[model samples]
Target: MLTWAGLLTVLAVLTGCTGSTPLFGDNRSPGDAIRIFPEDGAENVGADSRIEVTVPDGRLERVKVTRMEDAEHGQVPGRIAEDGRSWAPDKGARRLGLAGKYSVEVVAVDGGGRRSARNTSFTTLVPADRFIGYFKPENRSTVGTGMIVSFDFNRPVRNRAAVEKAIRITTDPAVEVAGHWFGDERLDFRPARYWEPGTEVTVDVGLRDVEGAPGVYGSQRKKFTFRVGRSQTSLVDARAHTMQVRRDGELVSTVPITAGAAKTTTYNGKMVVSELHEVTRMDGRTVGFGGEYDIKDVPHAVRLTKSGTFLHGNYWESPDTFGSDNTSHGCIGLRDVKGGSSDTPAGWFFERTLVGDVVEVVNSADKTVAPDNGLGGWNLGWSRWKAGSALR
Candidate 1:
């Protein structure tokens, strides 16, 4: 009952224009040839979500998955399957980064020589629990030759191997660096011997979404670099009350000092200066000695041990007390003024020291400092140090 004009209008609306896309846009018979996982506009995707791009009957030309807002760790690495139709991520990148946004761009060529491209985005779910690592030597810092890379985690790690593997260390003018685990919470890395002067070290941490324990995920993904400055170490003779400073194997200064009294002897062994303070409070009560002494202002304090040992300035003692006799409570003291001065022995040494500089104590009654106390890994032999690695 319809006329030719009316019929033509209905046919045009139904099939669209000749050889052109339909009204709803590219409504091809097979739709788009390219297929992307974690489809566009997805939110709260699981960390273990499958991520890939595929074409039903085509060869993938390009596939790039990038993490949003992290330029340092920009892309998620993957490879096209042998069949040339699919792509998958590497084993290390299987798990998506928790609380991270990702963008996927893909390109493929179909059997008919037609090309297709797609761009999609997704956001991963926030974790219920996350573990982070606190690392040492600081980024882009210049430390002494004895500097060691250390990490202290807030929570205990049950999967030590996985966590260790996540940390990648590389050096310029490369040397062999090994990692050692101190129980479950601390990890340290060092070369066989002290690092050569001017050596550049880079640490790449890719622990994001790694399961450190049951249901506990790691959340740090970053890179850090540091350079080794000149080598400076000091030797403290507790029995003789003298400290010898050395730089690059050259004897620089030999200054008078006072070691721990006989009853409270200083620890003997290699120690690293982990902290430096111009002035700090030293209370005997804090270190298990009650009513002995509490100094409100101890100057030029260089921390040597976790058990309250320091090589600091001493103004309260008699001027002659330094070279005469050892009289202190488990500390090495150098004669100094009430307020620290640059001309003083303690001040001169502090100025030349770096955080990673070594301070070794000899001829003391106390046993060698434990390898775990401060950065005392130098106390361990090369073989023993390597054996402590989880990888070993």
Candidate 2:
């Protein structure tokens, strides 16, 4: 298991490798004797492409492939056939990357051991299409174990299978990950249980030129990665008016808190923190409560849901209000000073919290939060989660 710190190592090591002049052979060599699938100087090749090298007469001694990706050149590992007349990439790595530039270098030999080399390069097709998915947690970021890889597509995906198949996600130590589509435009992926602390996840968005809709095609080619940090989950007991914080499955601390008022009960279920703010405005009207309240600057606010549910610091209430009362408009409140201070409970918790950390509310009068609400998919049973997968 690799911790959040592991993210920096991957970023530094895999950062792009620059391009250079052709190697292993002369670019001016007469490639007439060698045959390449993407022909020499070919252009506009599709994603479902074949790359091979063969010699009509002599045996192919060696074949090398270099793909220009993210301004980096990665060698394609392959094996020459037993006959030594043809060569292709390794089984799983055969799928050529979309919108990439590939260069193939080959060497052929006869019984005498004399070598003749040929070099060829081609460019893959760049999509003139418009369907793209905007994903979260950012490339190379380190998030908490509760983080779920989510996507919000720019348009409705009619060919869900085609679009989903193009995107591949893998995790270190090899845990099974499954995708669950919320609707035609939103998709999310996660393991059956919360990710173990210190796991590295990689995503290859090979959607470029893939038809996602009737006529619209995918228009992005990208590879990104993120790491899982330490595990932290807070259990908010609405009835008891306290929150129990745990780290690595061990109880750490318990703090007094206040949940929603009787008229507007807070939602119950697992909700992941998606954003943090030192201070933010909270207006009832914005969240569909017709102007009941509007605070200009709520300090130490942690956003929990898209529908304006927050776990924020409340300075207006009396200190005794927490731990003994439920008096908010569907938000959870922690005690803090006016502007907010590190010494206050709310500020202290906010400083230590990560974006993907979980905050589960129990014993609340309101119904469970919907699975589509702020990474609430954790509330869904494993069987139900897989049922939402477009792949199914």
In model 2, the runs with Cα more than 4 Å from the true position are 1-129
User: Candidate 2's residue-wise lDDT over 1-392, tens digit each?
Assistant: 11111111110111000011111122223333567787776777887777778776768866878774232347888899888888987888756666666777666775555455455667766555666676766677788888988887767898887877888999997899999998899889999999998999999999888988888888778888889999999999999998988999988778888898887788999999987767654544435554455453467888788666888877777666678888887888877765677777788789989988999999999899989977889999999999998788
Native-to-model Cα distance after best TM-score fit, residue 359 in candidate 2, in Å: 0.6
lDDT of each: 0.74, 0.74
Clash number for each model: 0, 2
Ten residues in a row with the worst lDDT in model 1? Answer: 10-19
TM per candidate comes to 0.68, 0.67
lDDT of 2: 0.74
| TM-score of model 1 (CA atoms) | 0.68
Q: How high is the lDDT of residue 249 in model 2?
A: 90
Decoy 2 TM-score against native: 0.67
The per-prediction CA RMSD against the true structure, in angstroms, equals 28.0, 20.8
